[model samples]
Target chain A: MTLTVRLPGPAATVSGRGQRWAEARAGSLLALPAAVYFLVFWVVPFAGAVWLSFTDYELAGVPAWTGLDNYRRLLGDPGFWNSARVTALYTVASVVPSIVLALAIAVPLSRPGRVNGVLRALVMIPAAMPLVATSMVWSAIFADEGLANTLIGLVGIGPRPWLTDERLALWALVIMTTWKHLGLFVIILTAGLQGLPSGVFEAAAIDGAGPVRIFARITLPLLRRTLLFVLVIAVIGAMQSFVPAFLLTKGGPAGATEVLPLYLWATGFGFERMGYASAIAMVLLVAMLALSLVQFGVLRGGDDG
Target chain B: MTLLTRRRLLAAAALTTASGLLAACGGSEPEAAVPADGVPRGKLSVWLHQTKAYDAVFTKLLHSYVQEFGGVDVTPLYVPVDKLDAKLLTAFAGDAPPDLFKIGGWTIAGHARKGRLAPIIPKAMGVPDEKALVAQYDQNAISSLSYQGRLYGVPIDYTICCLYYRRDRFAEAGLDPDKPPATWEEVAEYSKRLTSADGRKVGLQWILGNPQWTLMQLLALVKGKGGGILSADAGTATLASDAGVEALRYYGSVGNAKLSNPLSGFGLFATGQAAMVVSGLFAMDLFPALNKQLVFGESFDIAPLPHWDGGQPVAPAYTWGWAVAEQSKLPYTAWHFIDYLQREDVAARQLKDASLLTPVKGWEKLPGADPKAMEIMAAAAPHADFGPRTPVWQEMAKALTDAGDAVAFGKKPPERAAADFDQAMRIAL
Candidate 1:
């Protein structure tokens, strides 16, 4: 009884800290599986690839560490340089045609109708078709005596070696790739057009704006975000392109069509130079990241008005 | 349908499913098919290319092996030619690879170096030694399977690179149909004589644009003139040597003479648009089907690749063989199956059914064999040899082919082409 003293009041609960702790625990619980997956599948492999880039790995023995040598070799490799150039050129060539043709097709068929529906469906046919079958059909079409040449003969144009000629094979890839991928971009832009409020277009038309004026002043400005999205995706897809070059030209006719992916594949799997290939892969990854950043930055800054 | 009963059932089901998944993840390893016993009894997987064309052959041979020996189940998995190598690399990295596979013998050396293959020891095969093994098969076929002085596969098919000529086309060009060129000079003359005046038809069509195809085809010219595309051990490029330049000039003469074009695919050869084509033995099998009027010996025939002036003929060849994977659990069973396939009757039957030339000795005399084709194959067997056996062969092929195209189509001089090739190969090596 004598020792009884006034008990200190229960320590004040820091309400903000309590709330934050509970919220963090809940968030961690929700994100654990995804975090684990990313760590295991992507981050781990990426780390391994980075490590491998510094070593000589041929898949048969212990990887010997030869730091920076693979990267050094890549700098001096003419084949690597040629492939990088091809990859860059192909990315530009394919992305531009795909976006332009997609927009051209999308604008005309933007309005909803039965005929438009059928035409859109027909346009989507090539995109739906597998690249393997498409390659065979295109190969047949490009033959010296193939359907493409046969069709062009009516116009007094001679047979063009679509795939067999070194000067033309890369261009042929660009054309076929445009045809295959145009439909997706068309659908995306069409969806974007349909999402726009039609009242703006109507107001512009009522204000004596021509169709061209309406497009330039209203449509293009509104679709800038969608266009940028499509451009970045198209760029990435074109840079990573493989099958058309692999199946059609086999990176041949004196390495005329040897894009970066094909070259890295040959170096890694074909030549058993996994370390060198990993170095190539790191370079490709960095280049792709830089491209995406610069493009998004420039496109975003270009508008903002 | 009551909620309480359904909840209980659902809980039971979830528990059961989770247990089943765990069990599957930690299941016992499969028992080895080949044991220390009378006969092997289990699934024996055989991987090969062109399964549609070859399933019957593998089915028959493997079935007979099982019937004679003991109990074993065999399956043939067909992979496309383009995907086979990559598929093999993936399979080798995986824990379970095919027990047996058929692949180009020339590629065996590369696979061997990767430790993906097991050496085909003659003693283990029940043959006395490699000499006895060589006695039963064509040496040329066996040579391609050898890696570092040890053979790693059993050669089954000899894909001989020969000169396939059309008699009708040659006669159309005012050349004697009965005579074929035996020398490279004669080849040039024949090309001149066989080409049509209007240029609608050509004298020859070698696969030109593809570096791999062009280089392999041009090996005949290089090898015939006492030259080679690689070092003896296949570690360096010899394609820049004087002999190689001479070979490129010989290859370029086709375009220079206007006997062929650069972009012609095998279609030109198949449609008889070209009189003579440098192709493989397999081309003959497609002639009658491709060109209706064609008769085997009457319309088309194969001749050993023509040699350079006063030089020995060279039938540059590629072979496909049966190899045992290093991951094979039933190695004995796999080897035994290959052993059975190489038996005289089975090897003979393959040529007849599969339209592939067998490497087994006396395969030419097998039933369902054509007399004249057999004669040509027999004559060519002694001279047939493969390209460089190094894993770098793909690059070597590309360099030589680039040289070939520059000289042939780009009109670059042989010396210039060789210099470029030498420079490229310096990087490749």
Candidate 2:
């Protein structure tokens, strides 16, 4: 029961097809630059790094196929494990405090006011400055008689070798990193809070719920997605952090601050062991990916719940 | 071409470009350029670690060379001392290293082994052969810049470590201002007396957290105790020996670890917080420069580096060398410029202007040299240990630093620290 309705002429069809083809070509031409960039900068290096991880490629020599030898070596490499442990500890220590403090600060700052606006700008000043500049400023602050010790001394604590003691060095870096990154997260969370539906909090308040209860039952659950985003990003940034440790400590005070990135850099550039460094890099990449996935799953699952 | 075909072509071209870029990092040895004449004639790139005094002398010398040669154009890049090694390594990896550069003596073995350094061109240096060139400088200093029995560089800014003490601190501690600790035991006794109850003032402070200085400091102690960092053949770690443990124990016994100065005890010594510091000849000039009130003779003076009570005296030395890159297109020109830079008259000028000893023969007799400091250096020159010549010096240095810090910070027993160093080096070696 095929019945043909009045259709466009062949000439019309051809003109339409030609116009569509031209549009497709233009779209492709627009995308060509970005596509080439992705292929050249990102994909190629990633593929090369993965391949190099399986070889014995010192910077000065030809790469020789070593199969699983480099990866196998990582299992027994104490430096690698120490760096991994340091990275994990540093991530947790810095990220948790940073996110919590940011949220706490953001909650107060979320309300639109001129004073809050001024305070927000004041908070973001550290983030607006370059990381290297902040790291340098923090180096002076963490010195033996610097502000950190001076503040502690006010409470009767003696001056500690903040950057020189292994036990204290990582924590010192954490303190600095937290201070440097805190403002950005606060701004993020403040934006997230502003974007949230106001009606839920208003309804909760009208139902005789107190501010604390409203926040616990309403604000938090609503802000879970934003919190997850902040958490994922903070964790990734901490994991990839190199500047503070490198500039201040150079992975010293007995390797307390030798995070994975610094160790990878030392291995690759300092020791010229490109292959092993690449393997470490791949592991780091995998770890970051897995962590991001878990964060997504946990947050999405909470949404389902 | 068809649209789809053109897209594929673009993708292929992108892939090829990426592959070529990656492959370019595989370093290649540049062909050596033959000398046409004694006068240098080409563009030359020179890299140096920035030092105020040394830069002044070097810049003048560079300008003089360019003016004298007339045919050559010279471009100089001064990197910070800390960043020079990494920058040089990166340059090497990219096959775009400077034609000539100033590098540390420790890097000689590693860089030479990797075929990154051009061997000595005696003809360009106006010497008959490597033998003549070796005769021109102190043998120990010159030999320290060699690898695989081939000379790769000329020594500049050579310094043997010595003990620098504050006269004021010595007098304050009820010790004779004219006398200084001559042995490790005396140093420990002096340090105890000099250190204040508050622990801010300390004596004999080790430079904490610096690998090169840490290695040098520990090397002297370990060697003085009749132990060596590496086996004679440089194939194994021998730092766990009884001698090493004893030396480390002695190291741990002295020096207050709480004193913090980024300049490595030198700052402390300059500021009157530390009574003594182990330092190279450069500190003689550096002390006064660090503080205006600190005069060289009245406030601070140097003594020979202290040895273990019953051990042979050892003065650990390190040298910075001017080397030509193996990949340099103007190898001959680079060598010629280095030769001009290392002349005896220029060496004297370097001493007068920069306090940089060129380690040339008869350097002690140079007019501008301090008689007392020169005497100490001359006396110690025979015993100067240039440290272990190994291709894995960076790892070795880090390992030594770890062991040294462990002992200094009271984190581990001397025996355990030395053993851990051995274990670390077993993997590195």
Candidate 3:
């Protein structure tokens, strides 16, 4: 018995191959500007940094090759390791809470309502403002007599040196960072929640499932991919954060908030150690890449199900 | 036939020469040179870190420069002081630095070692030699602007850190405001009486998170106790010496590091939260400017920076100088303009308008100068110590700042902090 299989779409036109070729060519032309932008802005600098990592360029003279010296020195540098630890702590402290809080807010605001729309817009305002301006505002808020202490005072907590004390400076930065970034994540997760199939929720409701049960049984499982995306981006952003720490703490109160980017900057510009800074950049890139891969592997499981 | 051909050739050559001369005259940028009229002709680019008060006085001076030299044009760029170093470094790296700039005395060695600054030409400044140029200003001020025995800049803004105290706070604490703490030990004792119960009001709130000020403050303390940041040969870090440990311990003994003010100690003093601050002559005007209620010599007073109780006197002074870039095409003209800017008359105006001491010889006698402030500065000048001269000045500074903060905030013991600073400095030294 001979079986002839038919596909489930329109038949090929006489000029379909030619049409496809033209379409691809047009698409490539349209994407050319973005491709060039990626090459010029991203690829060139990355490659230059990789090359500079093996040199001894002090930002004043021609780069002289000194293979692996920068990386070797970085290995022994206590400051680098301290900054690495700070970056990791800052990332975990800021990212986990921000995503969780965003989800908590996003679930209720995901519903179709005028009030939700207004709330969503208001939530987006912090993320919309310039990071520098927001950082300055937060600096005031963390002052001794600022709003932060005033709020904590309501709970009978004595005034704390939020930005000045070594024990509290990093936590203060984490709090500011969470507040600064929570809005964008909420909007993103709200979009994700709204995109879930209503049929699944309807079935859960028919089965006598309450809002919490429906959320646990239907919403979360469906929103895994979106959560993964948000988590990866947020982690990357936290890993690269520099401004708040620089402006607020200067990586001080005894190196409490000295994140890697700030350390890299201080090395490159302050000490004129461009080569070592580039090595740091390279290491940071590799770590970020490894992190993203691991996150994808863990969070993206059971896709076929 | 030969005569006619020769005549035509001469005519053509004359026409070509005329056109070339016209093109030279019509060019956008005139070639930097002195014409037969002896007026140096060029466009100058000047970079200065902005102080609102200083900018007004400096701007008028620059305008006068352009007017005085009809053939020259001037472009002045004002950068915020905190960002000036980074901006200047970037400009230098790009081979596009301004013709002239104001640079910290501490950075002179580093920049000069990198071959970025031009050595000052005494002839351009109407002086006979380096000796004559050095004679024009206080020795310590001009010497701080030199590298390896070569003068690189002319000092323009100078300050020796001095104790500033509020008389009202002093009286409230039942201490004589006229006799500000004469030693570090006295400062600690006075701080206890001055500090409020809530730990908000304290005496001598050390400027935190500022590497430059930290170095200056620590320099005075360490050197007063007979220790130095670097050894005599400048080959090793000596910040962990006995005197250094004592200095840092003394530093940590006073002041509440937890005090949160945007302007650090200066803001606290202006608002009557702190009883004393170690600042420059500018603070005399700055306190009143920050708070109109703070009247100099009445509500507040100045005193010589205190020395160690049983140790030698050491006053830490820092200066900013007018320097010409090595890449400048009009070095002579740049120096001439700098000379004009550094005139005794202009220095007097700088003090009057900007409260920026110029450190000119006999500056204490400048007309309209605040007698008390000048007297203190003049006395401090004899013992003034500019921090260690090193090509790795920035690294050394950062290490000192880290150590200072560690001690002041009780993060680490003074001994450990000093040792850590020494270790950090080892990498750069």
Candidate 4:
């Protein structure tokens, strides 16, 4: 008698519950492919790399556990220190100029104009160009008899060895990296600038704020999140700077431009020190993580202020 | 309700199917192919760094071999010489590697030490009888293919360093085009005479920034003066010895005398701006293509490297060869291809086509061969000395270059640089 009473509306309730369950099951099943891909490609390789860092793994032979030996060797190695210093110098030198140049260009170009679209498209050309092609073109430009020197010479400056001189090699790399990445930074920052609410700027203008004042107080403050995003990206890009250092310098001019990635490549590929390379990669990962955290903290603090 | 759910499910499935099909259509063609014969079924890939003459010859050779041996299909992968070592190592570490490859002699020991090389003597391909091969190559050239007292590779070509001069430039500069320099002193004297600064043209050009070539030439000078870069056993660094220091000073003096233009050397040599340049026989094929007439001469009078004051001259020889991977499945097939390539007729044709000197027994003396090729072979055959043959030869070579660059760039005195180089060798060795 109780069941018969409940059955009066239970059919609809049961159907509703069954539909929700089916939808959730379908959603999870749809997600399964991506989950499998991520597990196989990313997670497995990353775990393997970390595990290999603790072993004496030569590429040609079986890996044997030799815990901390690679780390110990890395600590005492002068080359490692040299690489760390160069990497830091490279990051600061490349990222700072890139961001500054992007901001200077993008902020102005974000405004409407007859040539704004053309100019923005032009800025993105370098970003679309292949890294190897850019490096090759820059190599020609930085050659001893290249265009950079030709221009410098016209200004009554002596032809300097841009790629060959130890003192100037890193600067050459900085210029190359800045040029290569300026387009990307501009695109990101321009998007951020474009997304800012125009009403805030209009209000500022109505209050007798000049263009510079409006930008400083209203526009910039509002674009903080976007700038933070660009900063994070630039930092990551700078830390992984390889192509410029590799192609232009070959970590040369007496190892003046050697960085961690190049050193890792040389050790693993050139010298066949797989475990050591893995260890270096692990250190690089940790360093990158620490840098990201620091950048995050600074961004948060700026937002609060 | 069930019908509606089924419709939604079918639509989602259709979307995924369309996306996957689009992806498949956009992706590159799958490399794996089913072989006609069940034997030699997998892909047979060869990695090479020769993008010019050797590359052309290799492509042709691969075609011939695939026609000759029907089971295996071959793919030739090209890498730049500077990037080859790194790429090979990365590929070897992964699940797939080229079935066979050619590498520089300096790289053999390092790869062999890691057991990456297929031992030709016992495990894989049996070593060829040295006596049955060409007579132009010396024992040392054969020794370059050996690791730990066993042969691991087959010699392909020998590239000897010599003085390449522009016959027209030398004649124009009032130097005898027929007779090049016979000694370091002679080279300096000729360079000074040939050097001219008309507007912007400089006479002799040498690459100052490159340490390897500069150091290798310097080592030749040292050996010519009766000294070696290391002990015979490779137990010590002898770069700071009197002969070594003297060699460095001499090489530095070429830059110091302003006989050679450091700024314009690489470009000038390519453009025929320099009257005489010290380069390898490998450039013989290139000169003809550069719209220039080139004449070949030995390091000293088409003889051995110039003799020191009272010592016999020593010339440095460069050899490159082919090695089989230890992990290879078809060792006999690999051996067959290598042996076939070394046959007199095949070797001669390759040498003629590629403008390379074959290391096989008597391909140099083949009738109707290019005269310049013959002259180079004759000049380089005697007094040829292979560079240091250690597992760490590349590192040692780098160390030597660092020292040489210091001298070439005038960053440090030759003596001081040699000392530093010796110290570096000590650490690296």
Candidate 5:
């Protein structure tokens, strides 16, 4: 029921304030279940991980409280250091190409044409596929006698060990990662392009500006915020890549593709060192946050320029 | 919001609450007790790994078990191989482990040490005594199932590796189709002769898909060179000994010989792109049915797996077994079920249907099993032994595989791999 109050005074003093306040209270109560769910499921588990990181928790037995021991060990451990280096390389190799390729494709698909629309739809098919199912195809594609070599062989390039070759495994993973995720970014950038102001473009065209000039001065600067979101999400996604590495290489050909997340999993389950895995995960979380913040700052800093 | 909307929301919330409460009330036990004479009466939950072609056969066997026992309601749980470890761990941690679980034989000792497996009682197995039971299996097989001189699980199947060669490939290379290479030197020579000039068709296909598989096969070669991967007590790794180094060098040179065209041995051998492999009876199932080029006994044949020229022949036994869980309430019932499956005729039928070799003696003489396949396995069985029997055995296995991979990649020579393998085992143990 709609309730109202009557007061004979100034317009500001009249009526419906209590009803508005009641409405807000009702809305908050409706959201309480979702807030409680997040608190119980995500917040509590995250807090538990933080607590376990400082201790020696193997999950099979009682966890012993050992202050900063896991962290100290992680810092000094050669495997941890190697994994960090590999993760960094993997993040860069996957993210930079993904963003560039996404933008490159988005620009073509953003135009008004039937061909562009059809091409956009076709490219988005992989984005809908389950990564686990696609991983099998990728494994086949990266095999020694896979289609990659077959195609390369046609031009006399001969066969190359795409997965087994230690130097190339990370790159092969990067390329596959890009193939799987590039469609999402393409759609994001395409939507961003659609939201771009047409008057500005028309004005630039009227002022005798070329496509390159207009894009350089207007489109890129305008798309900074969207690109920033894409970059941050990409970095966070790249850091946590596990299934592909797990199924494809298993961090092998000499631990060349052992990203931080893969190492974290191996330590936790394979070796049953949960505390050390949690400690490494905490570090990864911090790295992801820091990189995301830096991306925000740099992308925003470009607004003034 | 309207009164009607509020009323509808309240009804929805109440419905959800009612459903939640209903779900929280777990299922009750069956009202009727199992009517059996000697058999224990209860619901028995047995967890087995997934086998697409044989799960139904096992389920049928379970039904027969139910009919024989009268009232025991047996629940068969099939876990996928990849997820079995996680599920078992979760089940144990949750204090709701199954009555019996089929696990890799190599891990029987490891799990037994963790108090996960219940010791098998001879009475439960219908044997006169534990002595008689122990006497039934070979020394190595029996010893592998025992922990601190106490038997804990029953070995069901044994996978003994042997040399599988293509008769057509041999004929193409102008070599003897009847006699496969019997020594490392002969294998090396045969590999070169059998390899295609363009390097497309490989001579020998090794288990390069996973390092663990490679390490398992290499154990046989390592044994022939007189280097034990682990000590008798599984206390120390002796992989860096003179014999161990020679074995590593020998295997490394074969891998490095460039005779291995494709690393995927299963696919290469199935497609007839590779001539030979050291494999189990798994190929007997895949090749005859799936291989477009293969015809059983005519195009392909098996012999005892080759080893070093001057060394004794060896083959690694990849075995799995069934054990009653310590947490089981129906331990006797579980044992009865396992015992039923292991009876002479039933055991032969079960294994034969799956193209698997039995762990029991005289299975070769039983009906249903492929005679030729049994003959080949029996020839190798005398020389077969499991990898190792330590709590840290798997860790050592990993180290061996890593060292083998390093050898394959030329990152480490055989001597260095052996040295590093010894160091790794020390760290792992």
Candidate 6:
């Protein structure tokens, strides 16, 4: 009101500086709760797990320190090798097809329309369903007299034990896991596609680019970031898969479906070798870390380009 | 000093606030609510593998106890049978174990040795007449449950392996409906005769999925032939004994000779694709549903488990039971429930409802039991054998199963498999 021109005086400068510092301090304080939470729940638990890995810890008693005994045993154990093979097969089987199937569905579903909306919702229903519930339903369907076999019988195919047969049980698990996880992949890919710029596509069309050419050249390159994110998540998810195999197969028909997690569970819980279980867990953690590092490297390499 | 700086600061603060909100929103479901009464509140969970009948009975029993007790609540959790040991070990290690749980006879010793089980005698529920009770239970089951002179859990029920055959199918094959096979050779002949080339059916099924059951039955046969699974002290594995090798070889021969439906095991039995199967009493209820004309009998000819040449009949019986948790704060209440469950009246009612045999004394006399059950009880009462009392029983059982599977699948000769089994047993011990 007085039309005073405030000059950049020392007092004004000092007050400004003080206010900025106060605001930054407030912001840091606001972030403190979350930082504390992460440290307490995640960082601390991880540290404990790492420490436990080196000990002969059975849950009931005090843990004893054993240097690399568990790891040495793991190296020589046939069970560990068998489990590693199963985990790798489980990951490859589920991840590759899941990505391909998700891409196939997502590209078409990205287009906006009433039909697309309904189809997308239907596809997402499996992802929305609880995993344990899905495993249970799949278990029944793969049973000897389950609906799948009943369907097979219509084609004059004799009943096969999808969940119980040694040869087929792991495959059945892979199928069920793929179905459950595919929807999430489709949703992620579809989001990436939707967020894509339309100008580039229009230009591509004007330059006489066909739909396939546009997708291959324009869409895929732009979607690299999202694809990398999905790939990393899918691999991690595959490695940690437990519920489907645990529920449906229980690592049976002669341990045909025994994945790493199940093997760890058996060692820790079944045999009461907590120390050994910890060692297995540590190995799994290390493997996951290595895989994540590879994914990080690829992501960084893509970013550089 | 400047509006732009203030606005930027506000925006940064808001973004941080939003992220905090998201983090809170994305957290997992909260832990189960602690009871307000604070009666030493902790999770009182129980793990079981049995579905339907067993689940219903145990769950109902726990629910009633919880209702009566009021201070602590009991939660019943179901695990698959094969995963029970693993799951229990994990849960116990997590320090969030079920207050009370069940394990197979073969698993008790291992759990006991690890001291995972709280001693039932001193801290938890104490059974009256522990020796007599143990004797009444399957000797093998009791032996497996015992560790270093300490009895861990009470044996709940005995699971006796028997032969389930289609009575109607036997009649069609021109075999006597009243008489089952009396010996291994007779079983083979009957199985072959019953087999049809129709695309849908097989002759007889053995449980290949559960190799332990097959091994135990084989051991029973060996003992019947005057051979044993181990020395009297269970200090060494006698699986490579002449009787043991012969017994396993016979089982392998049956598979090779196509006298038994090796591939069509439980699957075939469930779908009525097999005429005969070696199964347990627990599955008897489903047989009638699978085929209305199903008949139950002992392993051979409604007698006890088939004898070897001149030896007495020895049936292998597997048993499971309830035990109070060592960590249970409501030990008195848990014991009260256990004592209530063991009463003759309560035991009979539960057995009738669950279609399970009772471990309580004189409860077997409950009226209206199938005559076949009475026959089994009579035959099994005297000569039933159990595995060793050492904590190595689970490993030993696994070794046995592996040996049995090798023999059954023709992957290894019975003698070699038996020797391998003996090596495993020594390692376990």
Over the full model, what C-alpha lDDT does candidate 3 score relative to the true structure? 0.89
User: Among all windows of ten consecutive residues in candidate 6 chain B, which has the lowest summed lDDT?
Assistant: B255-264
Docking class of 4: incorrect
* Candidate fnat values, all: 0.28, 0.43, 0.59, 0.20, 0.11, 0.20
| TM-score of chain A by itself in each prediction | 0.88, 0.93, 0.90, 0.92, 0.92, 0.90
**Model 6 ranges off by over 4 Å:** A1-24, A112-114, A143-159, A194-222, A296-300, A303-305, B1-103, B116-145, B198-200, B211-218, B221-271, B281-303, B307-313, B328-355, B358-372, B392-429
Residue B292 lDDT (model 6):
56
TM-score of each: 0.85, 0.92, 0.90, 0.78, 0.84, 0.75
- Model 5, B159-257: lDDT tens per residue? 788888899989988999988898878888898888777766766767663545666677877788787888877788888888788777766665322
Query: How many angstroms is residue B293 displaced in model 1 relative to the true structure, after the best TM-score fit?
Result: 3.2
The weakest ten consecutive residues by lDDT in model 5 chain B span: B29-38
Instruction: List, for all models, the DockQ compared with the true complex.
Output: 0.23, 0.43, 0.48, 0.16, 0.26, 0.13
Error of 2 at B365 (Å): 2.0
Query: Which docking category, incorrect, acceptable, medium or high, applies to candidate 2?
Result: acceptable
**Tens digits of per-residue lDDT for model 4 on A89-201?**
98998889899899899988988886988999998998899998999999899876789989999989977778767778899888888888898889888888888877777
Name the better of 1 and 5 by lDDT: 5
Candidate 4 residue lDDT tens string, B1-429: 466688899999999999999997666543222223323333466787864877888788888878877865777789987777778787778745676788777678888898788765221222345333423345656678778876677777676666666666667778776776777787778777766654233444555545456655876788877777888898788878888888888776663222222233444565566655566656666655454443344211222244455666566677778777876665545655666566667677777777665565554575544666566656666777777777877667766766776676576787887787777666556
- Could you tell me the fnat of model 6? 0.20
Q: TM-score of candidate 3 restricted to chain B?
A: 0.91
lDDT of 2 by residue, A1-305 (tens): 99989987858667877878988999999999999999999999999999999998768889998998888878876678879999999999999999989999999999999999999999999888899999999999988769998999999998998987788999999999999999999999999899888777778778899988987887888788888989999999999999999998898777889999999999899888899899999999999999999988887533302
Q: Output the number of the TM-score-best candidate.
A: 2
Taken over the whole model, the C-alpha lDDT of each candidate is 0.77, 0.89, 0.89, 0.71, 0.78, 0.70
- Tell me which residue pairs clash in candidate 2: none
Q: Residue A198 deviation, candidate 5, in Å?
A: 5.2
Candidate 3 residue-wise lDDT, B1-429, digit = tens: 466688899999999999999997665553343344545568899999988899999889989988988877889999998999999999998888999999999999999988999998777787878899899898889998999899999997899899999999999999987788999889888999998888889988888778888988999889988899899777899999999999999889889887777788889899998899888887877899899999988999999998888878888889999999988888878888999999988999999998998888888798766888888888878898888889889988888988898888898999999998888777667
lDDT (Cα, tens digit) per residue for candidate 1, span A88-183: 999999999899889889998889899999988888899899999998888877776789889989999877766766678899899889999998
Ranking the candidates on TM-score from highest down gives: 2, 3, 1, 5, 4, 6
Candidate 1 chain B: worst-modelled 10 consecutive residues by lDDT:
B255-264
Q: Is candidate 1 or candidate 5 better by DockQ?
A: 5
